[model samples]
Target: MIYDLLIVGGGVNGCAIARDAAGRGLRVLLVEQTDLAAATSSASTKLIHGGLRYLEQYEFRLVHEALAERELLLAAAPHIIRPLQFILPHEPSVRPAWLVRLGLYLYDHLARRKRIPGSRAVTLAGSAFGAPLAGAYRLGFSYYDCRVDDTRLVVLEAIDARERGAELRIGAKLVGARRDGDVWRASISGADGRIESVGARALVNASGPWVQETLTQRLDLRSTKHVRLVKGSHIVTRRLYAGDHAYLLQRPDKRIVFAIPFETDFTLIGTTDVPFSGAPGPVAIDAEETDYLLDSIRHFFRVEIGRGDVVWSYSGLRPLFDDGALKASVVTRDYAFDLARAEGAPALSVFGGKITTARRLAEHALETLAPFFPRLGPAWTAQATLPGGDLGPGGFDAFLAEVTRAKPFLPPSLARRLAGAYGTRLWRFLEQARSMDDLGEDHGCGLTEAELAFLRAEEWARSAEDVLWRRSKLGLRLDGAQQARLGRCF
Candidate 1:
């Protein structure tokens, strides 16, 4: 089959493009070298904000676009994505009060917002939100954003794309491709060493960090654009503070780090912008980055935490468009597409996009290639809910109550987790089962055989890590024995 769009990566941008393309009545095929979101997509700070920091760099347009998508996505996938508030503690030593307020004001007003509340000033002296902070931090600002299961978002996009007539080939690496008359003939290698040759009318290089390498090494094409790889690392520690709200810490270096609630029991602290010159693959958090995070945390909270307190750490490379910025943090988070055609089908290479604007990036990608396929349908994903995201107007809280009421056998926590993860689609698997025994073998930390089977057969979860680490953070709760047993199933 000569696919209308053949995407080269399966990150957020890639899966999102496949979803959008398929919904537009185009024949789309998305190929991922590993499991979905095994790379950059899973490795994000996991916020759907407008990048308040970017406003300092005068990226008003990017901030506005991201903010608009923030509300749009909130309505689209209210299941996996939840509204979160970040408290920015006042640090006069870092910046004055007026400047911070102005930035916050701009952040709130940069774009049209409905579902999320705007920023507000707060007294951190005796409030629950300020209980974890040191004595000096008495004033702060609270603003709204969102948290998402980054990997599931990608998986859902792939699922939505597949349901909308797109083909997905996970664990398939794009080996190479060449132009042929009106189509692009490509060779792809599968996980079991099987090579498949396919044809596509056009191609999309959404290879995230490896965009440059994929262009040169796989397709043997030259590009004037460049990709700068920056590493962002996160650490999972025991809950640092109380309350569901997250803390946005301001650094002396004019950088920001977040301490968010993770897995209901742990705090997700991360994301240092370090220049990474190493190879592109699974990366571990650096010691300095850990120290950087630890020091930053100690500076604010009156809590005892060090490297020993660290439980789990992960790192992913951010494939930023290298515009020769001195500091890695300030690099543009905005994405760009380079559409090229040399007397053949078009190939659009994507560079530098964040999860917040992935849907918009996909829309713009199709727009960039609009001339190549004039008969493509119009954009319609803005109002469309992803697979299982439709909670039937009752919202997540209402849906969770309904799930628990219907399945009296399921523990409240397990029911809540599964409902949030799968949304309205929880019934597809749970509807037939009436009791815990029917759900299958019980793995510790709420994982069951029935859930594992659902992940493997429905979602493209091939390994234990895909279910534990990517699909959900249940890996943090599972022991080595349980992990090994789960791994054997895959």
Candidate 2:
């Protein structure tokens, strides 16, 4: 059977498109080269933010749309997306206090922010949030952003797409595509060297950093240049501060680094702007990038962080639109699509989108393709809840309480983690297990044999990496021996 839409990537954009299109009554199919969000989507900064820093570049429209979407996402998936407070230390040398205040004001007002709190100023000497900051920093500003389980977000979308009649194939790599009259014929090769061909009415390339590679090499499509590959890396260390609040540290070179409260016991410090010519899949944090991130965190906080403190590190390439910008940080985070139709076949190539704006991008993409499918259903995903996001009216805490009551033997920490990751859908696994024994052997950090098996069966987890790195961050809690043991199990 020919699908109405065939999405080539299973990252945020592709998953979002699949969900939207499927919800619109179109038959959809999504193919992923690796596990869902095993690449750039899983390796993001993990913030559903409007990017307050973009205000300096006068990207008001982008910031406004992103900020508006932040609240929408939080409402749609409260279990996975929640509000986070960012503490920005006032650094007069880097940016004037008044200027920062102005930017914060603009950030708060640019969008329809009903659920997230507005910005506020705090005194470093008196406020609880400033206890870990350097004594020289007397004042700070706190604003709202949203934190997301980025990998779970993608998976939820894929699940929702499947529920809405979309076929999702993981570990399926798109090898070739060509137009044949009114349809597009595509071939996908699985990891085990199994190849399959499918036909679709339209094709979508949402390959993130590999957008260009997919266009030029796989589909053999031509379009004017877009997408500048910029490498951003993150390091995970032990918790730096004592609060739920995260810090936005300003570097001496006018760059900003995030020191976020990660998991329950760790802090995630990130991100350097460097040009990347290397392959996106094998991107790793270099020694210099690690040192640079460490130095930036050490500069503002009273706590001294070094390479020894880092437990885990990851790197991902950002697909920014090339707007003749020399600096990586200055490049616009906005996205653009190249829609080309040859003979009667249509191919849509998406480039330079962030996790925050994926829904809007998908909606616009469908609108752009509406001319081809004139009989397609109208847009319907704006207010739709993603799979496992049907938390009813009480919110995440209520759902967690319900899950805990259902599975009293589950540890509080483990229950909360599962509820956050799977939302109301935790019942599927918990309902079968009567006691801790039924949960199976612990694979470190609340990850159990039962949970791993559930992931493999339901979430398409084919390898250990899919469970440890993408489905969850259990790798940080497990030692080498434990990882090896789990690897063998997989």
Candidate 3:
């Protein structure tokens, strides 16, 4: 059967496009070379902000569009996405105070922010928020963005797309493709060495960093547009501060690094934008990047951390559009589409995009493909709730209270974690469990056989890495032995 669309890549954009296209009465098929969000999507700084840094580059339109999506996404996925106050400490040596204020002002008024609070100046001296910072950083600005579970967001999108009659082929790599008359016949290889061929009227290249390779290597197609691979790495350390608020620190070089609260027991710092020349797969954070991140924290906060304090680190490649920028930092974070329809079937390739604007990107992608599939329905995802996102009128806090209240026998921390991760669907798996034993053997860090079964059956989790890292961030909490046990179980 020829599908209306066959999307290559199962990252956020691909899954998002599948969800959008399927909801519009289109038969969609999405194939991922690896697990869903195993690449750039899972390795983000994990924020749904308006790209406050883009304001410096005069990217008003990008920031405005992202801020609008931020509000919509927060409402749509209240369980994973929530408000995060960013403390931008004044660093006169880096950027002038007036310039910072101007950017924040634009960030506030550039879009109609309904739920998120607007930006404001604050005195950091002797305040709770200032305790972690040095004495020199007395003045600061507080603006709101959002923090999200990046992996779960992708999984949820794929789930929604599949429920809408889209086929999600995870662990399936597109081996080759050729345009055949009016339809494109593509070859795919599954993880177990099974080969399959599918046909589609149109194709979308949403392969994140592998966009160019998908066209030139896999499909034997070429385009004028190219992607610049920028590597962004982050390091996780023990909790650096006590507050929920995150800090946006400016360096002497003018690049900003974030120090955010992570996993309730650790601090997440990262993201160095360096030009990467190596292959994208199996990317790891180098020692130099780790030092650079630690130095950024040492420059701003009073706390002194080093490699000894580092617990976990990850790096992702951004398939940014090559606009002839001299530095990787200045490369545009915006996305562009390259539509090539020559002789036979049409194929659309996505260039650059961030997690904050992925939904809008999908919408724009559909609009680009509207000519090919004219019967597509009107856009409806803007007001839709993702899987398990509905928690009634009270939202997350009320939902958490209800979960813990209903399952009083369960540990409060485990219940809260389950509720936060699964939202209204937490009870679906927990309903049968009366006590800790019913949840099955603990693999440490609150991971249990019951939760593992749910992830494997519902979320398409195949490997232990898929469960420990992507499904939830239990990797940071689980030890070597626990991880080994988890690997053996699944």
Candidate 4:
């Protein structure tokens, strides 16, 4: 079948575009070389934020659009997207308190924020939100942003795309493409190493870190601009703070690091920006980056954390648009598209996008392709709910209550976690599980064989890493032996 649109990458931007296009009555096909979001999407800071630092660069338009989309996404997928509060400690060495307040003031008023609370000042000594910080810091600011299950967001988009009549192919890499008159003929190699050909009226390359590689090497397309590869890494450790709020610590070098409350019992601290020339996939946090993160954490927190405290660490390469920026930390997180059309064929390549801006990027991408798909349906994804996101605007607590009533035998923590991850779709998993025995053996932290099967059947989970690292946070709870057992089971 000749698809109306063919999307390459299967990351957030690609999956989002596929969902939007398919929902708009276009026949779409999306191909991924690896598991969905196995790249930059899953390796994000995992926040649906407005890029608070972008305000310094006068990126008000990007920040406003992202902030508006934050509320829309929260309403659309309350299961995976929810509001999170962050504490920013005041440092005399950094920006003045007045300047910080002014920037946050602009940030709060920039977006059409309906559900999230605005920023407020707090005394670090007496406020509950500042108990985790060092005693030297006595003043701080608290603000709101949304947290997301970045990987599941991508999977849900792919699921929504499939539900909307789009063909979704995983582990299928785009090997070659050529313009054939009014259409583009693309060749994709599946996981089994078998190549398949497909024709499309238009093509989109949303390959995050591999954008330039896909265009230059795979598709033989050339561009004057290139992407600068910047690596950001995160470390997970046992929870150090007492409260539910996260922290945004400012380093003396003018960089900010996030110390977020993670997974009930742990804290997620990260992300140092450094130039990288290594491969995109299999990116690992090196000793230098680990030490840098630890130093940053130690600088602000009363609790000291060394390498011994780290239980897990991960790294991802950001495909930033190279504009000769010398400092990796200053590189812009905004995105741009290169639309190429040679008479009858068209291909649009995307570069430098974040999880927060994916939906808007899709809308703009479709707008770019409107000339080719002249008769395609109008844009409609802004208000559409992703798969498993049809929670009827009910608050999370209300949704949890409904799940608890349906599965009385389920432990409160497990039920809440499942409901948070799967939303109303938890019903499907609980339909056959009447008792705790029906949940299968506990693999620690509520992970069970039944849950694994559900993920495999519904969430396109093919490997243990896909389940542990992406689909859920079971990786932090499970040890090496347990991971190996899960791998064998898969």
Score residue 120 of candidate 3 by CA lDDT: 98
Poorly placed runs, candidate 3 (over 4 Å)? none
Worst 10 residues of 1 by lDDT: 334-343
Kindly give the stretch of ten consecutive residues in candidate 2 with the minimal lDDT sum.
Answer: 126-135
lDDT tens readout by residue for model 1, 9-79 = 99999999999999889999889998898999999988888899998889999999999999999899999
Any runs in candidate 2 off by more than 4 Å, and if so which?
none
Per-prediction TM-score to the true structure, in the order listed: 0.99, 0.98, 0.98, 0.97
Error of 4 at 465 (Å): 0.8
Tens-digit lDDT string for candidate 4 (1-490): 6888889988899999999898888999999888999988888888999989989888889899899999999988999998999999998788999999999999999987899999999888866776667656788999999989999899898888888899988888899988889898999899899988999988898988888888888778998778899989999999988888899988888889999988889989989898988766668899999999899888888797899999989888889988677898888888888988866789999988889989989999999888777687898988888777887756788889988988898889899899889987777777788898898987777887788888988888999999999999888888889888889877
Instruction: Report lDDT per candidate.
Output: 0.91, 0.89, 0.91, 0.88
lDDT per residue for candidate 2 within 388-430, as digits (tens), equals 7898788898998998888899899999999998887877777
- Residue pairs with colliding backbones in model 1 are none
Clashes of 2: 0
lDDT for model 3 comes to 0.91
